[model samples]
Structure formats: C-alpha cells, structure tokens
Target: MQQYNSLRADYKFTEEEAKILKDLQPRMEELADQFIDEFYDYIWGFGQTAQFLKNKDIIAHHRKKIKEWFINLFCGKYDMPYFMYLYKIGEIHVKIGLPTHYVNSAFTFVRTFVLNSIEVHFHNKEQHLKEINAVEKIIDMNLDVLTSSYREEELSKFLSLSSFEKTILSGLKKFNSYVNLFLAGALALVAFFAIGLFVYDIYLLFFSDIGIEKGILTVLGSLLVLWAAIELIHEEINHLQGKGFAIGAFIMLAMAALIRKVLIYSLSSEKVDDLLIIGFVIVSLAIAYWLVGVKKKANSV
Candidate 1:
C-alpha cells in the first residue's frame, strides 16, 4: 500500500537531486546502449549467470528493457509510478529465481557506472562534486527502493496467509514435531532406496527376465514414478517445516508422472483412450507450465 511519497521519505530523495539528475538526461540517453552492453557483457562473463539467459531471444528482449530503464533514470521523475515500476523490476527478478547476491551485485555495478559517468563528464568543474553527489544519492535511492520492494513482495505472502493457519503451524506439540521428523527420516530412506532402484532399473533393462523392449520402457517409467514420489516427499517435508513448496516444482512433477505413465502404457495392455487422456493431461500441464514461466519472466526484472 506504500506509495512513492511514503517510500521517498525513507531515502530522503529531494527536488534538488531530481533536478540534477534531470540535467543528465541527454547524456544518459547517449550512453544508455554502452551502459547496457557493458552491464550484460559483465554478466555474460559469469557462466552460471549466462546459462539462464541461454535463449538469445530472452537476452535480446531483456537487453532492450535494461537500456530503456537506464535512459529513463535521468528523466528526473522519481515519483510513485517510477517507484512501482522499479519495484516490479525487483519482483520479477525474484519470480524468475535470481538470487539476492546477483541483485546486490547488479546495483553495485550500476552505481559504479553512474559514478564513473559523472566523474568523466564533469571532471574538475565547480559542479563536478555536486553532480557526483546527486548521482550517488539517486543510485543509492534506487537500490533502496528496488531491494526493499523485493523483500516486501515476499513478505506480503506471509502477511496474507490466515492467522489461524499460521497458528496451527506454529503451535506444533513436541510429540507432533517429533513425529514429523520421523516422517522426514522415513521419506529420506525411501529416496535412498529409490536411488538404489535406479541401479536395479538398469539390471532389469539388460539382464533380468524383462526383455529389452519392455524392460527399457517399464524400468524408465518406474524410475520416473519413484522420482515423482521423492519430489512429493520433499514438498511435504517443506510444508511441515512451514517453508512452502513452489508450484512450479509440482507442475514438473506432474509432467514427470504423466511421462512415466506413458512409458509404462506404451508396452502394456492399456486402452488407447486412456493413453490419449494421459497425453492430453501432459499437454495441458505443459501448456500451464509454459504459461506460468512466461508470466514469471514477463513480471521478472
């Protein structure tokens, strides 16, 4: 519910700082592309960071957005809408699973870029120190607004849940907590056995009574089902711990379960209609998953 007016109070952003930043508008616009390229190029140097952006189209699309944001920073309108937009940038980054370290690192990078630009363009002039001061303030304000929004967005989740539900989770008795711990241990044991079954799966495929054709499909199917089971146990444990599981994982687990079904039914006595239904379920889940991912990416910073 907080607006730019309230948020600005936290950063002490003033009209003087805004006016100074506005003066840099044309200069910022001129160097926007250079800034963006340097930013992404630095990001690309890190293999793990580059991997998520493997899609050329995704990279290009985001590159354009970053440049626009860079240019707009000097537009001098650090009002409510601008604040919300910046907040969305942070939220989207969270939605897509980007870690907090990257967020902090990126802001540091941008702060350096702005400070360097100020130093280079206004070197030794009377206004040089003033410009640097203004730039520093604005960038620091941006970092505050953006990172705070990310935390607030996540905090809102815990806030919105029912108090009764929260009470139930927090009120666990010693006996109940111990029981859940025991259940978690049992699930881990099952998961360990599941891994061993994978080795047995190979044995069944090549050397057991099941012939190659049937063995391959059935064994793979069984392994997938076991994997799905393990995933469920993980989520259940997460639920017990009050950490909540992501819906994204469940979608993937469902897809895996369906694929396992198809693998099993392909070689067995299953009706064609049932196979078709399973295929339909898979396609539906896949479409849902794709839509969810796109929604996340679009909303992500």
Candidate 2:
C-alpha cells in the first residue's frame, strides 16, 4: 500500500497532464455512466450468476449498488484519501473471491471508453496529442497497479492442491469466478438504482409536493441498499472466515436502520422504536456467527 502511494506521489500529474484531465473529465463521466449501465447485462449473461438471479429482489438490490459506485468515482475527489479508500475496495473485492480476469475486463472496458472519448474530444487538435497519450498512460498505469494489488492478495492464499486436486480446484474456481462476477455486477446495479431514487426524492422535496410518498419510497430504497450491503458483507465473510468482520457489518446495518427510522419519525412527531430493529439485527447476527462461524471452525478439525 505504501509502495502504491509512493508511485502516485512521484508520478503526480504535470501541468500538461492536468490539461488532459480537464479535457477528459466530462467524457469520463459519460463513459462511466454507460459502463455502469451495461455492467449487469454482461454479468447476468453468464449462467453461473443466473443461479443467484433466481431471487428477483436480490437482483434488483444489486443493480442499485452498482449505480452508486459509478457516481462516486466521478465526484471529483481523487486525492490520497480517495486512493486509500480504493485500496480497501480492492482488498474487499479480493476477499470476496472476485477473479482478476473480471477486474481486468471491467477496467479494460472503462479504458477503451475513455480513450475513444478522448479521440472524439480532441478530434483535430494535433497540438495536445502528446498530452492525451501521457494522460491515458497515467490512467492505465494507475489501474494496472490497482489490479496488480488485488491479484497479488488473491493469489497469495494457499490452495493446497495436488496435480489431480488442481484439476478439480480449477473447475471449481471457474464456476465460483462466474458466480462472484455476476454478484458483483448485480450489486452495482442495485446501488445505482438506489442512488437515483435517492436523488429524485430529494429533488421532489423542493420542487414538488410529493414529500410523503417520496419519503416513504426513499426509506424503502435505503433499507434495500442496506440489506444488499449486508448480503455482500456476508458473502465476503463466508469467503474469508472472518466472523468478527461479519459482526461489525451487522452492527453497521443495525445502526443505519436505527438512524433512518429516527429521521423518518422526526417529521411525524412520533417516537421511533429503534430498539426492536437494533435488537433484532444484533441477535440475528450473533446467532449467524455462532452457527456459521464458530461451528464451521470447530468442524474443520
């Protein structure tokens, strides 16, 4: 991680590079939006993911999250803190059994989009051609480092397979990769939809008289987003065998539910019964830890 920062620190964008960035921001945003839009279509196209897509509600939840992910990247805050945040994202994706190939493919699609957009943006401007190439190289290099970090962590784990076992493991890995890829894509879609609803609800608040209906819809969307997040966290925990992380995830979900309820009831002049949601989330998560985490560890012996 420190090495990654050092690479970025020494390779900061120059003035000419900054010009390329300025020229590309809008086009980048547009491409990012389309990349997110088509993510699900690609993911669901695979049969492995279709297994999880059996649950319509879960599928919808996943689509919403994907949208939020794309929007966040385009928010114009690519500082050190943002980079560190991305590092954790890479770590989490690896922990969840995401394949390096899919990550590579996803980024390749993004890079192609941006490069083509740049070609169109600077159609006849031969003067800044060198700067465009430099900027594209920087972006590609940065993404390469990110992908490398994720792959390194993923491949670092010992699978403990013999030649015969390797064949079985490879087949299993192929299936699992498809499953996680689809799951990741579906999750992105759900997050995106939720974000769209959230923004639209906010807009209606000031411009229209749909507060009550919009508030209800917003609360529902928020719950769906939180639920989808917990499901993703659970999947990651299952992969990593980290009950503690799963516990923390449930706690965060409980807190989110409580906070949302509090805000919802605030406008109604009614008392919010947060205790039930908190207690339920805690008890359920604790039971899950005992059943899945502790039991699995004990049985492994």
Candidate 3:
C-alpha cells in the first residue's frame, strides 16, 4: 500500500486524473472487444504467442482476462486494490517466465490503442488533451508496476541466497564481466590481425609473381575473413552492452577462414581433398549459424 502510494505520487496521479479516466470508462468498455481483438493480432505477430496461449481454452481465458484488464484501465480507481491487482498480474507474468520485453511491447500497443480511441471519440480539445495525459500516466504507471515484479523477483532470489552464496554469485558475475571484456579485447586483436592479413594479401596481389586470378581470389578471401572479424568484434561489443552472445558471429568467422582456404586451395588440384573437407566444414558452420539465429529469434519472441 505504501509502495502504491509512492507510485501514484511519483506519477503525480491525482483524483482529477482518476476522475478524467472514470469519465472515459464507458467509451473504453465499448471498445474493449475491439481492443482485445487487435491486441491478439498484435501479440500473434510475436510468433511465440502459441507457446504461452497453448490450447483454445487457455487462449479464451486469456482473452477474457485481457478484455477485463483493458476495461479496468479506465476504471479511474487508482486505489490500493487497483495497484495490488496490477502487482498480481505482474507476478503471474514473472511466474510464467514472460519476457519483460513482451510486457513493455504489449503496453506500447495499449498506449497507442487507447490514445487513438481517445482521438476518435473525444471532441473538446482541452478535455481531449487532459484525457490523453491521464491515460498516459495510468499506462506508464501500470508498466512500471508490471516491470517491478521482474526486479523484485531478482531481488528476492538474491535475498534468498545464503551470504556465502551471494558472495560467490557476486564474484561469478564480476568474473563473467571480466571474461566478456577479455573476449572483446581478443576480438579487437583478431580484427587487427585480420586487417594486417588483408593488407599483406593486397601487397602480394600487386607486388608478387602470383597469377592474377589466384591473387585476386586470395585477396577476396582475405577481405571476407577481415569482414567476418569486424562483424565478430561488433557482436562482442553488443554482448558487452547486455545483448545475447553472438555465436553466429564466431561461426561466420570460421566459415570465412575456411572459405579463404578453399579459395587458395582451389588453385592447386592436389588440394582437392582439402577443399572438399573445408566445404563440408563451411556447410556445417552455416547450418549452426542458421540454428543460432533461429534460436535467438525464438528467444526474443
């Protein structure tokens, strides 16, 4: 209750805003079905909706809950019960392992939907602006409470851990951070060497007695390796910034290196067996890379 009051105060959500929302309740109730229908359409685009909704019964129940929640959004009763209801919903989301991304994205759709509905229904400019502001505050507050569950969940887990365990966990986290930094540094070095390799390839192409065709192919292969190294470096940087580890980037580097070998090996008929092996390895890496991408996409959804 204290926290709820703090949230309301933080948003400066007052009785006036609540009354304004209450005034909009009837219109919102009328559009509840439409909101649910469109909401389903929007969430379905996430591609993993079925993973949560599962059967028709579950989906039907979910739809009903969503419609109810949508209507309640405008209930204009920003009291302990209302906020408690939101907290419970957030707990359910955390229990079901729903990604906070989905929650945030779903709120975005709700905000846009309600604002558009307001524009279509409201005529008075002043009242329209007031309603919009109130709706925005409510929506933002709801999102804040919802995401807070995830934060609290993490906090509780840490709190539950023994002091020694907490110390170990903290150390492991720092070690992981350091490891990621090391990887980023290593990738930088790899990129530097790749640049040198590219430069050397170019030098050999221009100054050496190598055949023009082989020289061009070698340089192109070197460029491919260099490009892959740069991409890996970019991926590592993103990982350090809290993005997923990019296994695909490492696979790409391997494939690029093998492809360069293939380009050079193809010049010598005697290296046909080696070329075949490299081709097989590249194909395997390609498959692994594709799988990694698919997994990442699924996880994001």
Candidate 4:
C-alpha cells in the first residue's frame, strides 16, 4: 500500500467521461474474456510481451478482466456513484497485488484492442473508418483516466490514508496561520528582509573574509521567498481549480523557509543571527501548515 501511494504523485481528473468509465468498469469486467482473447492475440504478436506471457493461466486471468478497465474509457458522467465502481476495481487489483510493470504492459494490449477493433469494424467503409479514427483519438486521450481509476480501485485503502493525512495537515495549517498572525508576523517579516541581507553576507564572506567559498545560499534563499509568493498567488491564475496549485504552494512555502534557515546561520552578524532565530520560529509555524492543509475545504451546502 505504501509502495502504491509512493508511485502516485497526486494527479486528478475532471472529465465526465472519466466518471462514466468508473461506473461502467464492473460491467466491463464481466466482458473481460472477449477483450482477453483479442488482447492475447495482439500481445503474442509482440516478442517482448510474449516472453512475459509464459504463464498461460496468469495471462488468461488478467486478460479476462483487463478488458473491463479498457471499456471504462468510454463511460461518461463522473460522480460519487461512478467513483464507487472505480474504488471497487482498484480493490480487486490490490487484492491480487498487481505488479506495476504489468499495469503499464497491459495498456499495450488495450491499444491493440482498440486499433484492431476499429480496423475490423470499419475496414470496408472509408467514411466509417475516418469517424472511428477520430473517436479513437479521443479514447487515447482517456487512457490515463482508465489507468488511474484502475490503480485507485486496486488501492482503495489509499483514500483513507490520504484522508487522514489531509485531516492532520489541515488542522496544522489552520493552527499555524493563527500563530503566524500573532507571534510570527514579525518573524516572517524579518525572514523576508533577510533575503537581501543574506546576499550581502554571501558577497562579504567570499571577498572580504578568509576566502570561504559561499555557495549560492543567498540565491537559494531568495528563490524560496519567490516560491512562497508564487504559492500564495497561484490560485488566482485562470482555469486552475486549485488542486495542483494548492499542493505546489505548500511545498514551495516549506522549501522557501528551509532555505532561508540555512542562510540565516551562514551569516556572521549577531543582529543577523537574532533575526534568523526569529525567522526560524516563523519557519517552524509555516512548516506546521501541512498538518491542516491536506483536506479539501468543505463546500457550503
């Protein structure tokens, strides 16, 4: 489970077609045999896949059900009910401990299935072939959706883990925000100012002091500040529903503060050290943000 979670790097889907696929997956699973036979023939033609199919029973089993996931690409309408099917399919994969490599290889079978099906269905009709080609292009766009749904369904417990992480992160973010408003506002301000100060320190340390090689610690510090600013402003960008932006924001802010901390101690001034200590306090508060920021904000009913 941990391994699966680690493989997924927080992607999302918003298309109604993805929802449709989710809902229709179980029914498609029932038609797995039809898909399997076609897919096996297709895979057997490929030397690489043929080598992997040495175990006939195992190959047959996956072929029978992988088709369920294939047809799911054509299902439209995304909603909670549809997600239930996605979740179920994911559980099935998990129960069987499906290998990640096989998941990728299985897509090759799907592509062949789709192309072969279209080719055979419209071989004699040029007009039908053209139409089918266009539709197949759209289906290709949805390949990722089917893959994600299947993987998610296979790892159903991940939803719970994500939910728990989100809950803890949200509470932490909220509490940090309040603390920042009170005890860390000055600290944040000092850290902000320290960006320039660190740059000066870097210049002085290398040229004026005992020839210590100063890394781009100052530049890194500035970058962190810029990153945090970007996070705070990312949602205002048009057409961004705030999922990727939100996660990016959290990561940038944390990184900015961490880089700033490294800069603070690198300086020689007592005054700078004092400011850095304060900045550290603020950074600590900011880092705590992950605790509360994981969960999605509740929509008003």
TM-score of each: 0.53, 0.41, 0.91, 0.31
Q: Rank the candidates by TM-score, best first.
A: 3, 1, 2, 4
* lDDT (C-alpha) at residue 255 in model 1: 90
Q: Identify the superior model by lDDT, candidate 1 or candidate 3.
A: 3
Sort order, lDDT high to low: 3, 1, 2, 4
lDDT (Cα, tens digit) per residue for candidate 4, span 228-271? 66445543232133233344355556667666666645665555
In order of listing, the candidates' clash counts read 3, 18, 0, 18
Model 3 scores what on Cα lDDT? 0.91
How do the residues 189-227 of candidate 3 rate in per-residue lDDT, one tens digit apiece? 988998899999889988999989999999999999999
Model 2 C-alpha RMSD vs. true structure (Å) is 22.1
Winning candidate number (lDDT): 3
Task: Give the lDDT of residue 266 in candidate 1.
Answer: 82
For model 1, the stretches where C-alpha displacement exceeds 4 angstroms are 124-126, 168-301
Overall lDDT per candidate, in order of appearance: 0.77, 0.59, 0.91, 0.54
All candidates: CA RMSD (Å): 10.7, 22.1, 2.1, 14.3
Cα lDDT of model 2 by residue, 237-258, tens digit: 4644523334444444445555
Residue 6's lDDT in candidate 2: 64
